[model samples]
Target: MMKLDFKNRIALYYLMATSVISILAFVFIYFMVKDTMYDSLDHSLSYEARKHLSEIAVVADTIYFTHKKEWEETEHREVQINPVFLQLMDTEGQIMDKSPNLKEDHLVMNHAFSGDTHYNTQLKDRPIRQTQIDIKQEGTVKGYIVAAIPIESSLMVLSNLSRTLLGLFPLTMVMLFLISRYLAGKSIRPISAIIHTTGRITKNNLGERVPLPTQKDELYDLSTSINGLLNRIEEALEREKQFTSDASHELRTPLSTLRGTLEILVRKERNISEYEENIRKSLVEVDRMSEIVEQLLFLARNGQASDPSLQQTVALAVLVDEVLSRQHKAIKAKQLRISMESNSWGNFEVPYYYGSVILENILGNAIKYSHMDGRVVIELNGDPAGCYCLVTDQGVGIKAEDLDHIYYPFFRSDYLKHKQIKGLGLGLSIARKAALAIGAKITIDSELGNWTAVRVSFDQKVS
Candidate 1:
């Protein structure tokens, strides 16, 4: 029910695995030693039984050791400290003879077992390893010689071994857990650094990045990805700040102009002609503000929603013609000659609203910037690969250095030098955003004071 952190969990898992292995190893060692002790005792018992059997004489159901020196051994005489006991039993289970060490306690013969066999039994409440051997005369059954050795020393050795293993188990587990926890903490140190660094980052310090680890492991990759995301966020924030500043300036210019005009008209009495003229000027400023607001809204809307369902099939040539028509007044004002060139192409599947916005802005720019009586050419070309609409104009072309920033909202090329050109500098920005929304590519190429050309390419979709 309780939760552990990554480090503790790793340590716990390692300890659990080690504990199982250590317990098994301890058990194996204890049993191996116990078996070795028992085997040595059984071997000794067999040798003692064989020695006694050679000295014993069996004469027609009567069995007795011929050598009295066999019972004179120190082991057969003593009851404690590695003592050996010897007992003889007949077919009727009556004891024929026994060593002095087993004076009151007799080794019980097991009838269920015959011949030579080793087993564990008690003598005077003390543990011992024992064996039974038959004494035969002329290949005829006579009696059994039971030999035993006290096993208290071997049992004490095993008991001490067991206690030692049991005591070390928990200590070993604790040591393993501590070592594992330390190593696990070291392994995830990079993650800790990342958390601390990222926590300190805020909007005011957007440029700061997380430090990357030297090793190219998973943690290093994670840090790299986090830095990349921070880069994007910083860039976005910068663009947002620039956009807000520009929008405020562009909107304020028209508002100030309208306010100045209205203030002048109300200050003095004027005839219908003067009044109507001032009202017209104010209305023009109002229209300019409204256009800027509408363009801003269009950009915001297109950016927020790009639903595929808004796309429909539209004829590229027809769309170009419609945009050209909308810019008819500007073209007339500039006295620019318009030309249209079309290759074999079918209708394109694109978001019609955005497509129209892209074309309108591109065409408007061409018309607005072109020199008087200059040529403006519209070319629509397509094949199986894709479709492209190219609009070129003999305009006061953009500078080479300024080309990169043309897509930025309210960014104009040489605005101070070409102050007479009337625009809020959002045409290209809107056009690019709209083009992107409709899955189109727009490219611009121009030479200063010579010509400017804009091209919009669409993916292959013909109907």
Candidate 2:
């Protein structure tokens, strides 16, 4: 299992995400306020510029008018306190009219100007920022008017805004860090519980289950499923323990009987005539034990079918013939007549022992469960899909409801209870494993009246 670092990384990610979002929001608002403030400043400067145009004293002979001294007084009062101050330069390169608070310097070199623009000039011995505009009548530039407004207030507003944002940013970052930590704890609690419970389940501690919640959210559902699996694993381990004990007990009886019988037969003066029969019975006992041991090893090895060396080319006909030959005695005694179905020999590349174990299980099941005069039929066919092997027997078949569980370990049909069958219900389970190891499938079709027919198919074909 992979270990997860649940606290620091989670908190960091949450904090980072929130900080990014908050900073982006702050930036958006800052720009909007900046544009709005600048627009208001520019509008006020332009409006005052238009109003201050009327306060100008036009001192030309053709444009002579009364109230010249009043205009001069008005310009002095208007320019002293008003925000928008104006400076007028003549075409003769001289200072024509300068407001009361305005300077005559820095206005030496300038030409016709219009629209809106910025310039820096020394006014009243201070550098003043100015926006220049031209007064035009009948498509001619009369002169240029430079409107100056102090940018100190705007700079103050922006500086205060920046300070406020900088101050709030750190505070908000701290708040977001705390919030991320809290949320990470809430979200990762279930995982922590799962980890703690999993840690408690060490070797031979299969009985324990993962902690779960009642809400059945995604994590809860996952925990619930794992708990259910642990229960099954616990039951399976318990059953395996019992099976080992049962097998030991079962083998001891046969071995003890054989030992006693052999002791009697080995007496010096006794059982010279019973030597062959005694040897036969002893061999039978040995054979049965050997079979049981082989089955147990098969069960153990089935879990690791990913071994690379097991891959091979298996001829279906050759495998079937081999299994049949091994059961020669049983077949002959039962007078069983069998016929193979394939027109030509076909092979499937699969695990080395796939067809061997599969045929052994099915055929052995047929032989063990068949009636006095029952027949077993086997057929192999190739279609567009790879190939299939079908085993049909006249023996008792499984019921519909019990069919699903028949491949589970030690799972046998109800018919086996009354019939003379001697198996621990591992043949079908092993067969199913072998089929899966070879990337094949086993499907059963049977009824109460007729016998069972198991079809094994390798669905994908090579040449």
Candidate 3:
């Protein structure tokens, strides 16, 4: 067996349904016509039998026609063109009299039949519609009157009707199938166009979008959804390209510094103090490159699927204190002032690794970006609804326009102006991703060169 495509399938289904209805309709029409012809013949035969019986009389114990001229009628005498035959028979089944048209042949009388009834029988080897009536005197059935008419013309009409219906059925179905197939093709033309358009789209042509249909139906919705998906893919690809370019530039700077320092050191011999300073400088570049690689790896790993078992109840205040302690050296170097306020909120259920990463990066950014002797506030506030941790720093804050792009990996606002701040821009990006993994949200509000506040809100809690 072969499989049919959508258009052919649609046509076949339509044809199947129509075929059932057409078959029933044709059968009904043929039967209705056949019944009509039989009914007309029966009525004519009954009338003829009644007329002949009216002219007959029963004398004592015998039956005979009172009017002899009834047998001389043209219809009774002729055997051609709508000929009707009449016969009379005794109770014992002997023929008493018959029409001249019947010649030597006689109509059959069925003894098994009771009352006046119409049926089909043959006379002289020709088909006929017949009816039988009993002649009686004082409730005694002395004889029976049988009347018949030829039915060959009516049979021929019915046969021709059946043939016409049978022949036209197949032809009509063929035409219906063709029309249905054509309509189905036109209906799905939009889908074909969508497939063609999407097939041409590649990474290089991600901006291409599918054309929408004129009607705002299901196909239009499908086209709109595909275009929306393409938009997202194009955006993600662009961000990926930018991230790669930034990562390469950042890593290359440290490598060049290391290479240049080593080349200078190997060029000529240096005294102990000069050698020590150069070695320390080279170590600083090596450490910077190592930090960049480590953060890149952290971002990549955080973006993957996390294990559910790693989730546990974590005290927000404790996590905040630990992050601050880890960044003590940076705070001390900048002489920054740290103040923490907590409302004694209980531990919340979260992925521990992701929670720690979120806190570590948020606090680290506060300490790194704050000016010397500037104040930094850490607030932990919670209710039965949710928990919020806010870290605000009074430092050279980010510009209002660049706030939206801050979450992009390796995105830095005013890098040349903040060159003294030695760090990769992946802190906030990493923190945001970690927060998302634990079903948390991060919001930042900042003014250029004034102050910045970062807030992490957790919607999940330990019951």
Per-model TM-score on C-alpha atoms: 0.76, 0.64, 0.78
Each model's lDDT comes to 0.84, 0.70, 0.84
What CA root-mean-square deviation does each model show from the true structure?
4.8, 6.9, 4.6
TM-score of 3: 0.78
Tally clashing residue pairs in candidate 3. Answer: 0
Candidate 3: residue 434 Cα off by (Å): 5.2
> Model 2: which residue pairs collide?
none
Model 1 lDDT tens row, 1-463: 5799988988888888989999999999999998898888888889999988888888777787788886788887877667889998897889988888888889988777777789888887888888899887778778889888888888899999999999989999889999999998999889899999999999999888999999999999999999999987886776667557667988888888888988998898989998899899989988898898788766655252347566555788888887788888888888889999886662555456778888888888888899999999988887667888889999899999999999888889999988988888899989887776656889999999989999889876422
Considering only N, C-alpha and C atoms within 3 Å, which residue pairs clash in candidate 3?
Answer: none
Q: Against the true structure, candidate 1 has what lDDT?
A: 0.84
Candidate 2 lDDT, 346-413, residue by residue in tens: 55443446668888998888776666577888898867777888888887677899889998776788
* lDDT, ranked from best to worst: 1, 3, 2
Candidate 1's clash total is 0
Q: Of 2 and 3, which scores higher on TM-score?
A: 3
Once fitted onto the true fold, the runs of candidate 3 whose alpha carbons sit more than 4 angstroms away are 2-5, 43-61, 65-84, 99-105, 110-118, 133-141, 214-236, 261-287, 290-322, 325-337, 344-358, 382-387, 399-418, 432-442, 447-450, 457-463
